[model samples]
Target: MAEEMKRMIALGFEGSANKIGVGVVTLDGTILSNPRHTYITPPGQGFLPRETAQHHLQHVLPLVKEALKTARVTPDDLDCLCYTKGPGMGAPLQVAAIVVRVLSQLWKKPIVAVNHCVAHIEMGRIVTGAIDPVVLYVSGGNTQVIAYSEGKYRIFGETIDIAVGNCLDRFARVLTLSNDPSPGYNIEQVAKKGEKFIDLPYVVKGMDVSFSGILSFIEATAEEKLKNNECTPADLCYSLQETLFAMLVEITERAMAHCDKRDVLIVGGVGCNEQLQEMMRIMCSERGGNLYATDDRYCIDNGAMIAYTGLLAFAHGTTTPLEESIFTQRFRTDEVHAIWREKEATEKKAN
Candidate 1:
């Protein structure tokens, strides 16, 4: 193992979206320090790409310094530098990549380009110690049910349109809720006070789910409620959460069933939802399985996950050449080859 040879330290930069995160981790999956800064737009205002990019640019260096300080490590101590490469907003992703390039040149260290979604899955697996569990990855820009097969993280299901977190954020904007901490957290709080279950469209096509219809219906419902005072915002939030989370759970369960996997792992920004976790726990209980999840610290886009995943890739001889260092906005989860999981892949093939 890399940890046995020497202490392998990796510095990770993650600014794929509105949040700018930096962290340091070792090869053994020990997170030394994880720090992040988020750009919170005003109510009813969504974060623009350019603005989010600027936010990352403004805070990336400071966050990186803070991470290094907290980890009690200097630049020379890092064995490698890692950054989020794709499956995120282009401008924000560029901010992370630019930082990575500058750091690699300054510190004279190798660099690893991490897939944002795969990083989340790897972090979930590391923290939960979940061996070969079906992953439910949900965030503002993505929703996918992933599992390992044939040396790759295969996507069994995904969002056809808007993601589950995007649906909730747009609805929060319609309601003019505070975006201080997070829109989804505010929605969850309001949802707890709700008693009525307003009917909302639930779209699940085979193993995939769509949130555009549900988002539109909720937005219209919020407007109608404003005009007629027919239902409380709490009730709308409650119903929305119920409908969307149920759709996610349904698709995730289907993936688990098809894979015949007993363990269910939830990762990403939306995975921090208590209601979603509770529902997943109930589902797993029924199947006599287990549910694994992390808190917002790891679940949300952070550098720790990136660092851990990068360590794994580095151990497997994966490195991004300086000339080829680039970011993509639409990198699929299945496109990544899980070289570190070759053992698991071979075992699955044998079985």
Candidate 2:
């Protein structure tokens, strides 16, 4: 393991999606400050990439300034600049990258490019103190069950289609729900009042799950109900949550079994759902295991994760040249070599 350093600091920029977050962190895992602004669109609408990018462009600098002020650190105090380099929307990724480049030039500090998914996993581990848990990553853009082995956070299973969050958000649009706080949050609120659990398609293939079919089925059912005045939106929301969360919990359990890991850590935006967490807790309790998950703050994508994970890389002598600091839209989680975990993995294998 890279020996812990004295007072290493990093500033992170996150704009891979609708939210733009700026954060500062220390090498010892203290989150100095994290601030974010989300770009919420009107009801029955999804945020466009171009508009989201524009929103980031407008607010990133201000958020960064706020983060610095909150963290009590100036640009000169930062050891390095970090930013999400990808597995996200290209335009938003570019906006963050541009900010990082400008900041690096101004501060004359090294740049650390972080993989978005890896950042989530690392942040979850840090906050929850989960050691070698089977990770269930569910978010707006991605879904996968992951575990660490060899030199990478290996993908044990993944979504064959739309992610769970995407499914929920699209369904919210169908219901003309506000996207302000979050479409999923609105669904959750309405789902609380739902008494009926309408049957919906459940699709799980081996270790992987597919939500596109489930989404299509529920959407069509919703439309039919709308035409005939057959069911309330709350009922649909309840049914959707039950069905989808069940699928996630099932796959997560399968992954836990396959890895022989008793600790399960849920990361990503959809991981914040209380229904999903309750189901996971029940499954873990039944198996005599444990579950670890962050609240909305850390579970959702944020600059703190990017900064913290980048500090890990920086501690181990990882740096990105200006020429190589470009963003990517398809950076897979398994593609990242977890150098920070090398010592920990080696020790576990030996023991």
- Report the number of the highest-lDDT candidate: 2
Report the lDDT of model 2 for residue 200.
96
Q: How close is candidate 2 to the true structure, as a TM-score?
A: 0.97
lDDT tens per residue, model 1, 193-261: 999999988799999999998887788878887589788999999999999999988998999899999
What TM-score quantifies how close candidate 1 is to the native fold?
0.97
Residue 85 error, candidate 2, Å: 0.7
Cα deviation at 106, candidate 2, in Å, is 1.4
* Candidate 2 stretches greater than 4 Å from native: 1-6, 347-351
Model 1 vs truth, CA RMSD: 1.7
* TM-scores for the candidates: 0.97, 0.97
lDDT at position 138, candidate 2: 92
Model 2: per-residue Cα lDDT at residue 96? 92
